[model samples]
Target: MDRRQFLELSGAAGGTLLLGSSAAAEATPAVATTNHPKPVGAVTYYTEIRVPPPEKAAVLAKMDELIALMQGKAGYLSLSFKQTIGESTMGRAYPNPKKAILAEALATLDGTLSSPKVPYFYVMFLRFDNYDNLLASGVQAWFKANIVPSLFAYNAATTPPTKTSIALDFHEGVYTTVAAADRVNGYMTAEEISTYLASKQSDEVAGQYVSVNNHYMIMDVNREAHYNLLRENLNGNTRSIFRPIPGDAGYDDSDPDYVANGQPAAADNTFFRKAVTREILQNAFPEGEKRNYLMHGVWETIMDHENSHLDPRFSAGASQVGSYFIAHPVEPFYITLKQDRFIKSA
Candidate 1:
């Protein structure tokens, strides 16, 4: 089924809504192409929710309701309560607002709310219209100042998660509608791209245990022809995916330079597609226990997300989802992951 058709399937039943179905309530969207630029004025939140197995479904339901409620409130934009993927610990960061909002809302409910003793992790993302609006608008500011700050106190807080990183992106002043995203170094040959990533020991790129192991190849394509054609086949809310940062241990500690100052250099699709595709193929996966599936699934999911982002209209905000979070300097080996609830352009 197409994207819209997939939305209907996400619903629980006739006249009933599930978590994924709730996010699909936004207006119908068009297709995307390689020519799309980073969205303008987008502020995204990256966090995780903690819940019990039995209550996981209910908490997720409540999260959908809270998201719908927050949308009604001022300054709130889009949000996603991402389901756990591959490994549970690696899915999303801890202390997510979906979990918190569920708890708070359930606290005021009747019988056995937040009961049955099941535990799950959830992250509530509250995207704003723009970076300025994130801090300026009271509705957005309230969540940051009042709601999101004290999240660390949660019982299931994933402290020092196996991985964590927050990503942010903004359109460069010199960027164009057709300018390609450039990140690989000056390597005319495939060997050079491999050498660049291999010798790369930057704390930002290569850190303890996990490393910047994936390459996302993005391009500019014809809008009406290729973009629209692809839109006809995207199933479910898969368009919600976007290029993720270098880390995924449930912490947003990735260096901000990747997205803040780093982007793929714009070039012909043939060159980028071939070069990035090669770089990704050549990179060595981390020798972790779940390396094989994680590497494959992570890259696949991320590529899917970036490709979906080709449709520029639906993703119309800046810093949508292709940069690393820059909360603090990398200390020694481990970087602290923080929530990027909204953008604050300087």
Candidate 2:
């Protein structure tokens, strides 16, 4: 099923299931402890799931069931699930030419949306007040029993005998919120971002068109220094907001002249709506033991995101931190499917 259908189903299935209270524990913007590598605050279990297009609906149904099961749990704070839009723009060109060529080609095809060769991607976020509470929830156990088997179940009904199961692939990690910002509360406290997001779902669902820019990177600098740099330098709207010229004939994203310096022309783009930064505390996937960070931004539109990359101010600020990157960042865009908070907004 498409995102809309899946969302409608999710709404009907779990809308009233909001459970848990803010008193259990609130994830505040983290403060790094000297002895522990992970920040101190709320913990999040983040997962990326890849499934064949035909199996998307079944998996999502399982997700809704899981959400229902987690309701009223002792420490549960919030849950959000989103689907990729099948569009990815590189923050910088890929180092591997083959991968870059392949990625570029796939973006133009429905393969990213669904295909045996390329599966659809989905992201899930489950937040809790603390590690102990998260462990008590038994969400992992529930997922293993209820959802894991379906991924590996063979479609014996298909024509080819050798074609067995099209099992889904997944990567999971435990993370902490480090820094965040939004238009509603400027430089937000951790609680503020959480509260803002509780109401964010309605706006996204209404528009049916929100752009989430995901920046995945491996950092070489001190984690705290990096986090502070991002919070202080990139948190504001400087050069992020679009300004129009007189008689510019309005914004046209499709115009051939709409690009400047490999990004959307300055005059045609607008600012992002909200942004946050997070760091994996455990179970780093793909690459292990390397410090990994995620910078997430919710944009008004895709063009708003593209335009920000070339802003001279952005370029200058980014250059200071560029050498700290061990690998080129992989940036992709996604749309929210379901977002529900059980905790009271702060």
Clashes of each: 45, 0
Highest lDDT against the true fold, candidate: 2
TM-score of 1: 0.26
Q: Which window of 10 residues has the lowest lDDT sum in candidate 1? A: 169-178
lDDT of 1: 0.25
Model 1: CA > 4 A from native: 1-41, 88-118, 135-346
Taken over the whole model, the C-alpha lDDT of each candidate is: 0.25, 0.48
Candidate 2 stretches greater than 4 Å from native = 1-39, 93-115, 152-168, 187-190, 193-202, 219-221, 237-240, 245-289, 342-346
lDDT of 1 by residue, 36-150 (tens): 2233333333333333343444454555555555545444544434332212111122232221122122222222323322223233334454434444444333333332322
Q: What is the lDDT, from 0 to 100, of the residue 251 in candidate 1?
A: 23
